[model samples]
Target: MKKVLFATTALIATAGMAAAEVKISGYGRFGLDWNEANDVAGALDNTDATNITSRFRLTFDVSTETDGGVTVGGRIRAQAENRDGAQGRATFSSPQFHVAYGGLRVNVGNIWGAIDSAPGLYLNTTSVGTGIDGMGFNSLAIKGAGFDTFTSAGVGRGGIEAIYSAGGFTGHVSYSKQNGTAGTSTDANGVERTALMLNYSFGDYFVTGAYQSADNGRTITKGGVAVEADDDVIFLAGGADFGQFGATLQLAQTEEADSVTLAGEAEVGAASTVIAWVNSTDIDTGVTAGQTVTDGTAFGINYEYDLGGGVTFVAGYVNTAADDNDNSVQAGLHFSF
Candidate 1:
């Protein structure tokens, strides 16, 4: 990341305000992605199983410190991505504004929800999971849950959140509301969500717990159809580092399903590392009677070689738990400034 000092002479002279600081940072990644599922026949068929995947992102962070020792800041990002053969136009995201004092911080707009911010919730991979683009993030315990993270485009979750950290303990809470079109109770798109997360660390070990509830059920599309959302979810994760090796166990339960993931990372030599994870999900068949839901396990492995100067070579393979047991592989370069 690089920082720039803004010329705020006018503000300093007229408003008696401190000069604001701006930081610019981001990364670019491109790779080849091969998916066996894409090679299938029928409506989902793809003549070419391998394709290019790439993303370019730039983030701007602006902040200023007040005389009262409070810091106010906002973040916005511009990003574009190409997956398979479909390319997305570059777009700027809505700003996330924040205020901080001491160990407490509050954020509004495009907020990152508590569950998404909890430690150990994501595996240590190139982009937080198996591949450059997380290989669909099948290894996550909350793989199918609707949670908010930092959005790179569009008006993400318009939420408000508070986070606090002191010593080895951290806590976060978030709330969001989305009012879509009105409909029946089971098909309503209007929803409200509240999430909370707590974490504690001691020595080389850390544990985290998070919970989220959605009122009116957040709407999500499945199999090209909008479906009822999960009403609530609970997540728990624990991890520890032993020398150059680290491992984490995470569990997530929702109104209709439960999932567990075990992930590990190991350092090899001085510039190489390997990360792997296994995830299993079990759905309550009775609840999803008409839906095509299945219980299965997925696993993935990722390898990275550091080339210094914020550059790395990354490769990964994943075997999904779908009925077909499809698989994928990816290789690429990732760089940040």
Candidate 2:
């Protein structure tokens, strides 16, 4: 439901034939989770099982179309999430806005990083998942020729992005600059992220790819500078839909390591798997340097049954390993309204 903020809003719609609509939508899930993840060599570490995790999100979509056919819209997202009994207070993401004409769109403010939002770059899982998963890998791991990842970098002063869709093809490009401190100090600890993506769909089949790079290479006056081109990631994904069944495969490669992710789904259920590893470990990506690393093999599966009224029952598990193997299986009621 939407409430008009001012009488001018209604009058503008009536007099200008403009569309000023606001929408509220989100989902909620709650269940048990067994997470044994840590920062340092905790592969052999044993932690508690029976923990709790839940997530609630609400998005406000506000949009308006001018009489001349220009459309402007924005989204405000409020979210509350929990992991292992650490239920933090709800928070809101900075709003993002878009201006669109025909097939081209420009976005500003808290735009999702290109690699993170690019279509066909990542596999879909049925259950809720923290981007960090069992395979010890996620989407940003594909920084092409570079070795660093900034796709999940903190929200900077916002960003700018553009998207275009034509026929069966769609293209996306984005840039975010987080220059440190006050003045123009590019040498300081800051992040500059750039990503380009392309997606195409044909019949029941589709394919997508992305090239992303980041400059988190900070330099010191006396010390030294981290190597440039050390954080490049590249990604690709393809799949087909067969009415009742759908399947997709995703691959991500960095200069130091690589990963593969697979996903499959039916009308009522879905499954996903991820495998990641390092070869000779020339670079410190994740695994032990100079040692053959198998990071870990992670898997997640879920089943859902619609209970009508935008509600359903969901059950799923996510597993990944570093030093030792760990996982989480959850069953809960999911709702959308």
Best by lDDT: 1
lDDT of 2 at 176: 74
lDDT of 2 by residue, 1-337 (tens): 3234543455565675555776677778776665545323544343455556677878778778888888999877887877655545677777788999999999888776667665544444323233222122332234224322222123433679888999999898888766577776745766777888899999999998887777764321211324444246778888888877777777776644566666676663332232222211123353323223245555555566667776766655555433464555566666776
Worst 10 residues of 2 by lDDT: 273-282
lDDT of each: 0.83, 0.60
TM-score of each: 0.89, 0.74
Q: Candidate 1 residues 241-295, lDDT tens each?
A: 9989999999998655689999999999999999999999897554533333347
lDDT for 10 (candidate 2): 55
C-alpha positional error of residue 299 in candidate 2 after TM-score superposition, expressed in Å = 2.5
lDDT of 2: 0.60
Candidate 1 displacement at residue 246 in angstroms? 0.5
Give the lowest summed-lDDT range of ten residues in model 1.
1-10
- In model 1, residue pairs whose N, Cα or C atoms come closer than 3 Å (at least 3 residues apart or on different chains), thus clashing, are none
Q: Give each model's clash number.
A: 0, 20
